[model samples]
Target: MSSSPAKPTSQHTSDHFRFHRPLAHLSGPFGNDSFALRAEAFARFFGTPLFLGAQTLIVVLWVGCNMAGLVHFDLYPFILLNLAFSLQSAYAAPLILLAQTRQAARDKAHADADAQHREALAVANETRLAAAALNSQQMLTLLQQNTELTEMTRQLTERIERLTVEMHERFVIHGSAP
Candidate 1:
């Protein structure tokens, strides 16, 4: 059985940003390739506690091993360790900058979309207000027409009663006097 996708309700449709067409492209800065994705992930991991802790542990072990004479790969100056740190910084600075640039672009896109959504809402509210005002005026006019009709009916009823009394006096009282 082929099932169609469920239709979005008003709640889902009202999310202007979620359905915004322009911001869809801005959702990812790194092109979908594995390398670009990996680079972005690596940049994100740089400031994490896990990354910092692992690096600290490795550095301590390296220094401890060298000082204790258990490994003499790079001795007093720790020149090799310093070189490794330099290489890491070289790669890290650019990747971090790239991530920051991507984030800035996404932020700008969201901000623009939000501004457009607000404008649309304001226009809709104004239209609704104008329609409500027009409806109120129409209702007022109908109430006035009803009031005028009721007054005319009351006057007609009073005039009929007066005419019936005058006719009764002319026929009954005049005929009795004769």
Candidate 2:
């Protein structure tokens, strides 16, 4: 089998990230916050399979140990487990909301940047179209002028031919009479 060489790309194709340059200052949400960043990460971890599986395994072990009489830390009611879940929920709810709010802000910035880029492209397209239209109009006017000059040259050539023929006839007739 024969292999084909790679096709060359234009400069426009290489500028895919040009639209994102303006959003550089708005990186990682509206502003930088070490605590908020950590909390966001923690909140994100709460929804992952790894955290869920680990939590489930721990709860199972706790119940198994208590039921088997291996430990007397909590009775069958499992009030301690309930309190732990409540505490986790108390922290998780606010952190998740914080993460969501930051994400929404970042999304808005990106959308605005995209809108600006699109507007710039539209303006450029209009400029190019206007220039093309003007060039076309100028070319048509030049063509008209060239056609008029050609017609004038043809008329002058015909006049010169007629004058030459009349002069030749006069010279032949007058010379013969003499």
Candidate 3:
């Protein structure tokens, strides 16, 4: 443990320590141990081109030295070299597996997030469609109400015109020049 506190990463969640996904160690439920992180980093480094090239160079030099009688170590059979390969494999396999497991977990998390996003988008679209339907209904009702109001206004105007004519007739009957 260092004097400083661990910083949280975006991918970290409340349950991050339960699973090792992307950035869980960077910022998660549990603070990462520096030594463990360093060891994992070192284990991952074995897969690089630099490591492969260096290993090849060492093997070639070892074989050449043994073949030329300059070095008698593991002569002809190269049992020591074979043992080194076996040892490397034993350690490398587990480290590689650890990295793979971590990567798989990270991929699963991304997939889950994508699924959640898609679901949320679908829900939003559904909500928008529902709102549109309600708006359409409201618009239809308003239009019907407007049509009814217009018809009532026309009927009222006709009735007023009939009344005025009746009043004019009554005034004529009384010999008024209206």
Candidate 4:
């Protein structure tokens, strides 16, 4: 009697269905990886081949002007081009770094927010449980008190009846003697 192995259960099947429902419109297209997004932004801004081509064209134009004697021996165009490229690099590097830092901070903030939400939910659930327990205890105490009061009332009534009968017998016997 050999038994077949059980199939493995899907990990996120419920979550997938929950998000894919018609009314669930809160799903996002992006995953958790922000580094890839940041890298793509950096590439779009600074790593395009077109920028290199433009730089090369500028250099060529400066060289051509210098060679044709149309410019001075100081090579001012070349100096300016180099200065612009240097400045662009300086600023672009810092901007990219800043973007990455901001992304990290944003991710951290999201994680912190999720943690806080979970903590709040846990506290709410605990409060509900505590309240339910307190209500149950109070109900039990009230029931016990009601039972004790009922018993005490029954005992007092019985004692009053016994005393009344004894007083009536004593009064009747005294009246008959008179």
Candidate 5:
């Protein structure tokens, strides 16, 4: 087995993967907490009875003026209404874009934090594994040393016994001659 790190080969390349993918082309930028907050704000602003009453008042005033023949079809009231709608659309688009940008930034921050946490966890696990390997190696070395000491003790005991036996035989042989 090779000790080198694994490298991606041609077989691992994805046909569908694009290196030049645009950020604007990706979806789900508005699918976050800030976007939800902005949507809720929009709903709250537009869904109020006060807003409805104001709209009704404007429509009634326009119709009343039209019926009374005080305002012409090509003049003031219709133009004002069109201007208001255009302004609302323009402002709403930017506000929604701002909310989506904020949400995307928040999501990116969270993703970065998660990546950092995973990296820390990987480092901790590697440290634990290295410590375990070191402990195992130390234990094996100690056991080998212990076995060698026991064998040395046994050999020393055998040599002591043989020397004692030789000394006894010499004593017996000399005493019998005397």
Candidate 6:
């Protein structure tokens, strides 16, 4: 239940084992809640196939328009288009890096949580096993005690029966019959 993983001890030995695989939480740092999350979302959008297709289409249109002489915006050297791509890369790099940093933080948090969970489980299992061992030992001791008590009771019963028979014989020998 603690926020961090517990260290292994001699009593709780299962803590030495690892059984959990922590997965990344990709809930996006900038969701609908804040601008930071939104910016991260927009930054990640560029990595998708949809963004690739859209960019390819725009490039084709730009080339076709220039070759057909329909637009004089970006001529032979395509200086304006090249400048636009440079500008896009300049902004894209940092935004993508920011989102990546957020993702890394989320992953670390998830990993820490999962480690704590595994520690709890291992401790529970070790406790159960220890309890079972103690119960087994107590049961054996009880059985042994029971056997000794039963033997003692039998001996006492046989002694009582012998004493009763002897007393009866002595009474018959020393007194008149009824």
* TM per candidate: 0.81, 0.79, 0.71, 0.40, 0.49, 0.74
Q: Quick one: ranking by TM-score, best first?
A: 1, 2, 6, 3, 5, 4
**lDDT value for candidate 1?**
0.89
Per-residue lDDT tens digits for candidate 5, residues 1-178, read 7699778898887854332233333333444478655764774466589988988898788777876888777354567768877987887776667666766776676666667767988999999999999999999999999999999999999999999888778778566442
- Candidate 5, which ten residues in sequence have the lowest lDDT sum? 17-26
Clashes by residue pair, model 3:
none
Query: What residue runs in model 2 are displaced by over 4 Å at the alpha carbon?
Result: 1-13, 30-36, 171-178
Off by over 4 Å in 1: 1-17, 171-178
Model 4 C-alpha lDDT per residue in residues 42-84, reported as the tens digit of each score: 5456767887898789778878888788986537446766777
Task: For residues 1-178, write the lDDT of model 6, one tens digit per residue.
Answer: 5598878787877643243333323466644458876687679798999999999999889988998999888887888889989999998998888778877877777778777887998999999999999999999999999999999999999999999988888787767565
lDDT of 2 by residue, 20-40 (tens): 888776665424589756766
lDDT of 3: 0.79
lDDT of each: 0.89, 0.85, 0.79, 0.70, 0.72, 0.81
What is the C-alpha lDDT profile of model 3 across 1-178, one tens digit per residue? 5598667876654763333444454431112578657757767689899999999999999999999999897898999999999999998888777777766776777677667767988999999999999999999999999999999999999999999998878787766764
Query: Which stretches in model 6 have alpha-carbon errors above 4 Å?
Result: 1-33, 171-178
Q: What lDDT does candidate 5 reach at residue 3?
A: 100
Task: Tally clashing residue pairs in candidate 6.
Answer: 2
Ranking by lDDT: 1, 2, 6, 3, 5, 4
The list of candidate 3 runs beyond 4 A from truth reads: 1-31, 172-178
Best candidate according to TM-score:
1
C-alpha lDDT of residue 65 in model 6: 97
Summarize candidate 1's per-residue lDDT along 103-173 as a digit string, tens digits: 99888878888898889989999999999999999999999999999999999999999999888898897
Deviation from native of the Cα of residue 86 in model 2, angstroms: 1.7
